[model samples]
Target: MISISETSTQRLRALAAATAAALLLAGCGTAEDDAPTDTDVSASPSAISLPVTPVTIELVDPGAEPRSSLTYEPAGEQSVVLTTSSTVSQQIDDQAAQDFSTPEITLPLTAQAPESDAGGEIRLRIGTPTSADQRLTEALAVAEGSEAGLTVTDTGAVTALSISPNADAEDAARAAIEQALNQAVYRSISFPSEDVGVGAVWTTEQQVVSGLTLNQTTTATLRERDGDRLTIDLRIDQTPESATLELPDDAGQLAIDTYTMSGSGTLEFDLGRSLPVSGEVTVAGEQQYSDPEGTTVLRQDISDTLRWSTP
Candidate 1:
């Protein structure tokens, strides 16, 4: 029989490759000079009304980028496309008082994926600046641990990312902080269009491959304007899919079986802040795999929520 340890090692490497590909992005903010400012909104005490005509989605906001850890080529065809769907919601409480002076933000997040795949429904709460730095420190520890089979470090990046940058943290701590900082910077997508009016539609597509043979075609439509907020509808056409496996050294001819997956959701972007307030998405599908061992089946019925708020 194949060594279980070897199999685990190979599987982890494959998953890591797939993850990196799916989370492709450029670097993010690091210097104290990179702090974010509240542009595109009203400075007055009262809330401002929605903008007229077309509106654009800012992709380079200092503090509003999504975070990622892994890095790889975009997913491609003749590979697996791992699909992800999200349903995020946001609400503003006018009655509750909040301090606008702080740069901190708390975002609630959830995710679900198949076991054979590299995903499971995970519920996580993330806070910006310090909390974000701390979480990265923990993850970095795992990645650099002797048993973690790693040999990389970036402690300085962690210090730079912290609300209180600490250049003195250990190598593992810094590496983790940098990793977290990278992800946050990547989330801030740079979209085009000066103004997107009601009924206007936009699409974001990538020809790069992250690992899986798949599509990431997404369409967003300006659905409605309810006073201070704008509702946007979204549809995902493909997900990242790819697999790295270790077959018997002398294994013969091989065959692969694939399946179908699809999903839809909505995003609530605040007209005032021009940021996604909240939204929800649901995705369902089934997949099958086979080999000399016989056959294996996988099914996915996953849903998730994303919310953003501040006072």
Candidate 2:
């Protein structure tokens, strides 16, 4: 396993760019008033807390060893492309798959976005099985898998990002180009997804993350400035839960019982304007299987940030 130091931890602090912050503007309106002066106007930070949720579904195992990474791409007016990749590994009981038709599992993941001007394709492959499903009833039966354990490794990659001339963006493009030159800003962007989607992922709550597994419960508050900017303050947490993987008992695979976990963190964001963000995470989890009942558990606390920009 890889070791983490204070210096490495501070670098991770930059990951907060992934979450944004708040921007408030002051204004006033009056009937028959030709114009308003700053003397008569004042704006306060919005105190309202609206619901917030996650736009993408991610499957993660916090206990796995952290993966090393490299990013490379060309830059210019021609066409730019960016690529990112990370790997994770964990130990699992071999008998866990006895009841299932297959010996594999599936997880939700994210692909990195390339540089804005990079016109490249983004693709995600399991690097193993592309898809698999287990019966809910079968999942509930086995409390644990066999005594023998196996090593599992997984990788996620974002292969491309594209940028192009926008005829209609003459206005927005101009504003972004101007802003990009001076002040640094972080923006939180959201996209609708038909698969692995959440009903309201932007809520405030705590989250628990285990080995490639995540459970979150939260409440979120959000305020929007026209359609351009949004401010959000939220609490998120992840913990392990008792998950049972059931396969046909006749399949001779080990039944598996998952350990439970939980934790919470604060997340703040800026829609169009970027701000520095920081937070912490704590979680615990273990893996076990039926028959001889073997177990593996892990616990950790983490904090990190990344440069973030959204459109």
Candidate 3:
């Protein structure tokens, strides 16, 4: 058995609350100044609509000759099985590392295009998620048969997203599902307007507000192309927008001393499909925060992998 002092217990609770709030806002895709404090998952899909932020992709090099537009061509109905897994480790101050890792989660989804092509809407229905962890399985029980609606452009830009979660779901579970959907819908590579062949290079910039505001940049290079299938390499970097972070509920403020995050990965995309074929990304960072109690250092490691297959 483990025992925690009263003061430590209070600190842990505050940390838990702050972490939860951060995760909920991370998926908003809005700037830090405009992000909402809380997300309403029980509301109607339209009422819970997420702000649409345009991703700007600038081409640095067109690469070799034989360049062609990489665009999505929606065909008939499609079904895909996505296997995703993530691990997170966080250490605060001099305490032991905390294990917040998530077991491998397998989600089967179906995508259908709208009858009219005017709006370019795609409706996705997410089936039940399977996980080896009993706690995660219980938390995701209400997520079964949830749906996500997205409006995307031919260049793989997701203009709008709406998620509908079960009304009876817990706040933490609902937030987790929403965050997962947000990443699944928006993390795909958005092709540039200009055509490019193998070795093409481009970069995209976006802002994200988790616990702290971060400017995220991704550089992508086309490694190979075969018909509608393409393999791309991705490098991601993140920087804090400010040095001070105000914790929710007036818990306390943290003055960031130093922060660094960077990662690299590869993705396989098919223009004929609604989602990526396979991909994996990993990010690790460390930061020092100071408060009235004292200075605390946090180190985090996070990773996610995706696998898709036609049913």
The C-alpha lDDT values of all candidates are 0.31, 0.22, 0.65
Candidate with more favorable, higher lDDT: 1 or 3: 3
Question: What digit string (tens of lDDT, one per residue) describes model 1 on residues 1-311?
Answer: 22225463344333323323223211122222233332222322211111111112332212212322111111111111111222211111122221111111222222111122322111122222232245543433332211100111110001111212232345444333333323232222223333444565566553223223344455666567555465767665554344422222342211224444445677664423322356544433333333434332212222222223332
lDDT of 2: 0.22
Q: Pick out the ten consecutive residues of candidate 1 with the lowest summed lDDT.
A: 148-157
Kindly list the per-residue Cα lDDT of model 2 for residues 1-311, writing each as its tens digit. 11134442222222111110000000011111212222211221111111112233232211112221111221221211111111112222221211101112221112332345433322211111112234422331221110100111111111111122122223322222212211111112221121111222333222211112234543333322223223333344444343432122122222335433333333333222222122222222333434323332211222212222221
Instruction: Tell me the tens digit of each residue's lDDT in model 3 across 1-311.
Output: 11245554456445534443233223433245334323454554322556556778899999899999987876667777766555656666667777665566666778876555548768777788666677777877777777766778877877777676665666655655666665565356788989898999999887655556667787999999999999999887877788776655465666766666666778888787767777765555555555545545444545544456566
As for TM-score, the candidate ahead, 1 or 3, is 3
> By TM-score, how accurate is candidate 2?
0.25
| lDDT ranking, best first | 3, 1, 2
Per-model root-mean-square deviation over C-alphas:
19.2, 24.6, 4.7
